[model samples]
Target: MHKTLSVATRLAAVAAVTLLGACAGMAPAPVFSQDSLPDTVKVPAGHRVVLETVGVGEITYECRAKAGDAMAFEWAFVGPRADLNGRDGKKLGTYFGPPATWASNDGSRITGTQVAVAPAKPGSIPLQLVRANPATGNGAMTGVSFVQRVATVGGVAPALPCDAAGAGRKEVVKYQADYIFWKPA
Candidate 1:
């Protein structure tokens, strides 16, 4: 009985260690570099990078008729729902929008516009070059000038057909991307 109890305790300890290691591997923090920013996200001469965040989100889309046509299917961006993470895997904020907003831990936020887009890998949303509208809060995002959504994975709109009958139908697509925020140097 003593030997059997010892074996059971050893097995439980091993299982606990394995579980902890797996959890640690689930979502490793992202690495960043200025040189790694995609060309699609243009940074005007002398503007410096202020912060970079890694975002995991769903890019929502709505099925509607193509513009200028009444019987076609087209996917239109509704907005996004994401959790922004810092380099240490800490939750920094949440991103959501019709006018994309990045609200950080310290209550700072910024909105932006799509200035440019580049092709992304198959099955993923296109890389975006966004220009910040202006800083709203007095947080980490204050004075932010531009933002880039790159290294995209998944989040493509579904291939559902949309007619006038399906005009308002919505779909949520899963995606992950790195968002780099910039400011004037």
Candidate 2:
């Protein structure tokens, strides 16, 4: 009985070590670059990129009267629904909402206030910077100080006319952007 217990303990220890080693072998998160980004969307000094994710999904828009002008109508910005993926193309989390939440699969999440935005290429959505609030839960989102949205593609308002005839109609436009999360250096 004593010999059997000793062998089992040794096997468990080996398994634990192997598991830890496997985790350590995971590829490190990719580095972020801002050389081509506009100054308005750049992460502020003293922060370093901690995680970089690609957000691939859609933005919803609604046909509504232009704010402050009842006579004018347009496709108004609504919200986003996206999956955040790592460089390896694995789903790491999600981004969505009117409040704009970024949630990690590890159960960590954050909501942030928009800091600034700059126009991207003609057909793409603007690049943006956000200041993250204190994260809820823990894990990947903990200690995030900022989030930058760059490399935007096709998130602009729908091309459909937004006249009174289409009032209350909703449309979803496909988009992709890179979200780089930063922490104080």
- Could you say which candidate leads in TM-score? 2
lDDT, candidate 1, 60-132, per-residue tens: 8998777787777688988899999976789999899977888998988888888988888899888887888
Q: Please write out the lDDT profile of model 2 over residues 70-145, one tens digit for every residue.
A: 8899998899999999988999999999899999999999999999999998989999999999999989999999
Candidate 2 lands at a TM-score of: 0.83
Q: Each model's number of backbone clashes?
A: 0, 0
Q: Score each candidate by Cα lDDT.
A: 0.83, 0.94
TM-score of each: 0.76, 0.83
Q: Return the lDDT, model 2, position 18.
A: 100
Q: After superposition, how far is residue 173 of candidate 2 from its true place, in Å?
A: 0.3
Question: What would you estimate as the lDDT of candidate 1?
Answer: 0.83
